[model samples]
Target: MCESPVRHAHSLLFVPATRPERFVKALASGADCIIVDLEDAVAEGSKDSAREQLAQHLPQLTPGQLTRTVVRINAVGTRWHEADLALLRNWTMHGATVMLPKCEDAATLRGVAQKLGDGARIVALIESLAGLDAADALAREPHVVRLAFGHLDFQLDVGIHATADEPELAFARSALVAASRRARLPAPVDGVTTDTGSAERLAVDARRARAFGFGGKLCIHPNQVAGVNEAFGHTEAERAWARRVLEEAARHGGEAFSLDGRMIDLPVIRAAEAILGG
Candidate 1:
């Protein structure tokens, strides 16, 4: 498996690549990563034109840019896959991460990785029921650097009731989290909240995702970026607690200790270090 640099608190903003007018605006939207989306956002008739637009604009991106640019290509069984792959083969961008949607199995991922040839990274989109079921195997693929949940499509596919709490989708989220940890990848990212202007709702959803072990989230609009970043980022209180936990554990010579009258175990210390980015 190809190793990637440890991801920071990233806010991945999704934009329709078919709309050339929106691309520049999305690039300037204060996101850590800008996803040039060719799937879900683009209409059937616009896929060809979107591919053309992406091909033309992909070359203009320079290295050391503020945003990490990626292309979200269509699924393997779709008509756009061949053209998308062909376009990506020649496009020059800084560390292009291919967002493979609806990734069902390891074979499909291996096929894409073979084409990328170590130059690009793969972020597997585990959307459907089958994809969730095969997440562990898919994560084992050498090219898959990140895993993102596709909540909207997943809800429809599994006939699950969607809510802010999303009790029915909990199993899928847990599966992805476990798979990511098993593969030693960064924590999986949560799906998007389509309500663009509702920062309050976005904050709530972001917190829920964080509690579920997601390291980051996908955003449909720029307005939600700050809230998502804040939700995922460590607060001063968390960092302080983590530091204190480590100090106490060290004094005990790696034995279990208690802080603030609460018992601190190995898992607790590890979680604290994770939050502090140690």
Candidate 2:
């Protein structure tokens, strides 16, 4: 049920939170961000143990590592969410990104913001009908740096038995992208492709996501990272545009400036950084 990352991540690879053993391996998997998941990846009986194990190892990552790593907590209604929030509230994580699953509105984000208090960056997952309906509100939340299309769960929620061909979810994906752009957030993160073994399929999905204005794709397997990254990689024109954006931003002292009528703020700056590998 987890969403995506707030930071500019081209490929966010998920590693089960219960399997602390795989944490290091995930870090070395070449993903732009490695998300330690405490949601679907953890069994109901093992939620607490997963949280505890995650809390123990999460802070061990160095500052640089923390930037590229995130934690996907349980959804709001789950029994594990409160404990998950408590763990995050009390921990000494230096700049950990937290992925909020089943985000249906801004109120939930406001509550989370009060608890985290600007200590974390949030990625809101629009999984349910309520979430998709409230996508604009979720995007408007101050702590939410990005939105993600939880395509699988949404399809389940809507009773659609569609495959990863993704035509059925086009409207949903487009809505998310529009919401994100209107809110001046980074381009939304697309849902993961389940066919992790098929690099060709993964690349196709990644390209489709990019075409829909998504900035990145989630990865269930480390093997999918490179393909996703390649699909979203900057073209020559993108690199040139990024250079221009940064230069114009710098000229205006990096404040809320503009270049070619597009507002240049933190999200745009982050996107530019990603393009130039800044």
Candidate 3:
């Protein structure tokens, strides 16, 4: 199995695969990862054309490229699944990860895993109530490496009242975080902010998601990428505090220690390690 890279403090920017002109520029953007989206972003008639275009560009990426590449395919139960799988099978791209949308069970994942063999990785997008309920089982599937929340579809599926604060979707977000932790995966990715240029609003949303234990946030535009990265990356103060707490604990023979007069223990150490990408 290929081990996933330690992805602390990174932005995954989504680009519509059908827009061939956007592909090179997106990959060249400073974002840590580029997700060529074949779902939500692409229209019905354009899906196959997008797949073919992606196949042509897949080989153009050189070794040791700075940005990691991923493909967001349509939901498993949708009509697009077979073509997406076929494209993935014949491609020779390096470090390609598939983002499986609307994943609701382990069986669906097992099928994809069998197709990808053991070398490829799958990222699950938990979008519906059924998928949220099945998250633990889904995460345990052999091919799944990460889980991401699909807030828009989730809201529609659950009939949640829409608000800027997203109060109605809080439970689903919490469930995703808890399930991801239980499955020992990296922190689940938060959903996108539709506004392309509103950095202040994006920062607020990103910070809120980070507070809820999300390690990353999705982006609809390149402008949103930097803000998401800034929100999720460890602050200097955080790094210093983590180091102090660890050093104090070590000095005390691995016993609990006080940092700024607050008790710090194993959980604190683990969280510090996560932030520091240790």
TM-score of each: 0.89, 0.83, 0.91
Report the lDDT tens digits of candidate 1 across residue range 1-278.
22333244368889898776776677678777878899989999999999898878766766533227768998898888988887776542246678899989899789887776656578899889999988999988877778999998999998888777688888888889999999988889899988897888899889989888998899999888889878988888989989889888889988887788999999998988887773
Model 1: how far is 238 from its true place, Å? Answer: 1.4
Candidate 2, residues 1-278, lDDT tens digits: the string is: 12323456888889999888888888888888888899988899999999989889976877677767777898877778888988876432466778899998789778986786556678898898889999999999877878888888999999988765769888899999999999998888999988767888888899999999898988999899888888888779899999998888888886898678888898998989877983
Which candidate number would show the highest TM-score if scored against the true structure? 3
Task: Evaluate residue 159 in candidate 1 and report its C-alpha lDDT on the 0 to 100 scale.
Answer: 89
Q: Which residue pairs show backbone clashes in model 1?
A: none
Worst 10 residues of 2 by lDDT: 1-10
Q: Tell me, what's the RMSD of every candidate?
A: 2.5, 6.1, 2.2
* Best-matching candidate per lDDT: 2
For each candidate, the alpha-carbon lDDT, in order, equals 0.81, 0.83, 0.80
Residue 236, candidate 3: alpha-carbon lDDT: 93
Lowest summed lDDT window (length 10), candidate 3: 1-10
In Å, residue 128's CA in model 1 sits off its true spot by 1.0
Q: Which scores greater on lDDT, model 1 or model 3?
A: 1
Candidate 3 has what TM-score?
A: 0.91
